[model samples]
Target: MSKKKNKSKTLKNEPSSLHLFDQIYNNPHFHDIVFLIGKEETKAYGHKLVLSMNSPIWKGMFYTQEWMETKGREECLVRIPDLDPKVFLGFLEWIYTRKAKISHTTIYGIYKLAHKYCMPDLKQYCTVRFRKILNGRNCLRHAERSVIEGISKWHKISLKYLMQNSKKFMNNGKCFAGLREETVRTILEMKNLNCPEILLFRALKYWAENIQNDLIKKNKTEIYERILINPDQKKITARKLVKKYLHLIRLDLMDFKNYNELIKSGYYDHRILLKEGFNVVKKFDLKAKTKSRSGPQLSDSKILLIGWCRSGETHVNDLINSLKSGGIENVTHMDPTVSIPSLKAMQRYDAIVVRSSNVNSFYKGGNLGSNLAKYVDEGNGVIVIAINTLINNPEKQIRGKFQNQNYIPLKIAERERSEQCSLGKVFKPNHPIMRDVKTFKCKEYSHFIKTNDLNGGHIIASWDNGYPLITEKRRNDNSGIVVCLNFHPISTRITNDCGKAWLQETDGNLIFSNTLSYLIKDKLSKLAQKNPKKKIFYKK
Candidate 1:
């Protein structure tokens, strides 16, 4: 036998505490047991943990320092990948508190820790603050680098995004081509930049280049006037000429790093107000789906969305993606434009959601055919994308002060309504979506919807102009509730107009979370009823 054999035997008897601790700490509640047992005697008194102790994935989501060491570095918050230095400080607070609060600060080192160390709760805090400080037109160079750090972290988390947006990075004009292809490939493979901010930087890098081609040739006669007269007049070195002008280009001052302190230390609350939807909507639910799965009675089902991947699609894709990711059982989709119309093809889903305004039907008149509206109205569960928008305008407005679970419309129009942010606007304080929305400071901007017959509907979200942007109607004249929204926010008149997309980030967060919750609650309750929990009451 060898000394290695002797050591291996000792290891088997002693057991690796790191491995055992990792197995146990994953269940946060287990700490309570140790606490109950008293700390000094924990090593011997605690029961041995084995692979059998595997907890559900949810329990595993919580990470500890030991775990962080095992996972490589970096944490990612999907909210804002550009964890600019401003976002970094907030991440620090989140790490300390385990609660994500919005902050505006630029501290790259802290964000780097959050991204590397499995610190999402902290990362989210940083993202909120970053968003606050950088909301307006006054973006500076110091803040950009920090945001770039965040973007890089998110790249570590989502290759889907990197793979999807690769072309955009190549096209954004970064002197990427100037850099050696091998270097560019390594950076891209490493996911080194926030995709969007990376796009912006690449653009800036191009503009900063000194190279140029004379489009319409200027007279060289004047060019010779100074150089030809030369040293007799005054001599200047090439480096001197370059350095002097380098001081002149104010754009060179654009560094994301420097402005980050303002994000952390400045008036961020006011910045959040600069976004049109800041106050109008709310942040993400982050509210986890309860494992209990209690409530209504139903069967295992799936939802198929039609017209989702059409020529124009917006929030629909995001909503569907979220439901699937959240583990909300029983959901699927087939964009009407993507699949050929056939009753058999459409019949696969227990529920069908039409996500766009354009209507194409295989269910219209044939045997396999069920009338489009009638088919949905009679289904077990159906979500109709702005049904009214199918026959009307593609854009819709979002406004009405939410109040007592209802919106008292300040204004209503058949077409898209401008942002109706009015002082009179009121919203339901207790509404789940509005819970985070109350603190949202708002900036005014408009989103369009394809809708009609605004009367006799419950307004869920409204515009500051005091008009209803999202409404639901349930009445005797019509049975199924009408979820009135837009055909596509991106396709509407606001593509680049007022940054309806940027400002509405919160709205997208709110509306999608709410709608998905509604569908999940409705679907899950019904299913839970069929699978009742066993009773286990006892008496002495």
Candidate 2:
């Protein structure tokens, strides 16, 4: 009983760990070190033992061989250049008390210091705190500043986080000022950026103008005299600031109104516009073609055709002709079986069409389909044509190929067999793909593949037996579009042939053209809506 009572008293008398830290922090009477930080030579106090224990940098400074011979037992003075006194104080407080006050203004500085001092826990704490403070209003400023001042590793982390989470903030025009040229180019290159290309141009213009104004303010008399001599020189000088970054912007993505406004605003040089071969009259003519019932014509869009085509086969050629007839201007055919292009090369095209004779071989070759799925996620368009061989063996061919990919819209059924082609009914008659399309006709022995709806994909057209024949899925925010046609839309058949390819003049051709048009139009329309007005340019 007496021992138990003694133990209870001992427990009551002992202080908690936090209380001990607070006591150590409050008792500054025996501080043995002083850090002079920043230009003002501000002093920060801490115990050498505590500092050395918490920071490897401090340990090296106090206990290394040279230090022990010079100033080991004496009071030590260290200078930290360019570091804010308050930030250093926060660091010291954390070292002594296991707690520190962190805010937006001080977070980056503290993170830098913590990294330099090899304090992983403190660095992690600052990183978490900084992420929490990121929002639509402040993300741009934080990102710009971090890139400008952070180390390479920290810069990468900050940029990756901003790209994934702070897209809304990047849309604000004010965020563009004072950015590095490489940073601006990187942002423009992102496929999934929510901002329009035109707005990005305006932002680049604003930044260039601001940089010129700052230069003029700093060299007031010289610049003023030069400008007075040649009034056009000011415009020339401002354009020079952003010239290197200009070509990275995709001028083709801009609509007619926005493109015209950019030209008239005098933000870019006439020589550069001419070099890009941008003719105002041609642009206007192209805009006029967007009003067709097939939806907007993709005259400026680039389409990539991937797969093999035999010399005598007219299916691929016929489809290409149909697309060209519907006003698509640029189409490149590539045989992925020969050599799969890199993702960067693939991104040059606006839409991708994949046709494979052996679906299993295509799936196993260099992760092409998965990479294409990533491309689709970045606000592009994809059309996948599953051949009869793939459809007839859904388990071994279709599901096996696409088991790990989410880009395919349809889920394959277990049972796979060939069935006589029946007349297909328009599942959604009002859908853009079915705008002028009525009954879909196909050749006999054209295998009908069964599919389940996946990724919110709805049946755009179905067979008379109610099996889905066509599926369409649009991603969130309309970032991308995917359409899967179960049967070949383009075929080569003689007039008397029964089980040949689709007829060139059949409804299948029209539907295929309309689907391509709709996907391209949707992508362009969203780009136009990214920033609808010029007012955002004046925000800063």
- Candidate with best lDDT: 2
TM-score of 2: 0.46
Q: Tens-digit lDDT track for model 1 on 1-540?
A: 699999998878984554445343324443321111122222211212321122222135334565447542343212234334334333323433344445333444555565566556455655555544542122222223433554653332223233333444445454332222222333333222323332433433343231111112445344333232243444433333223223222221223332232234232233554464533123322342212112221123455655443334455555555444322345555543334345455556544555443344322222212333333333223444442223333221111111112221122324453452322243454543343443221234444543334655666665545544455544332223335543233322234343333233334444444554454344334444555784321100
- Give per-model CA RMSD: 23.4, 16.3
* CA lDDT, every model vs. true structure: 0.37, 0.65
State which candidate has the highest TM-score: 2
Error of 2 at 141 (Å): 3.9
Please identify model 2 stretches exceeding 4 Å from their true place: 1-19, 38-40, 64-69, 72-76, 79-82, 136-138, 157-172, 220-236, 241-244, 267-540
Model 1 misplaced regions, further than 4 Å? 1-301, 308-333, 338-352, 357-381, 387-413, 417-435, 438-445, 449-456, 474-482, 486-498, 502-504, 526-540
Error of 2 at 27 (Å): 4.0
Residue 518 in candidate 2, Cα distance off native in Å: 18
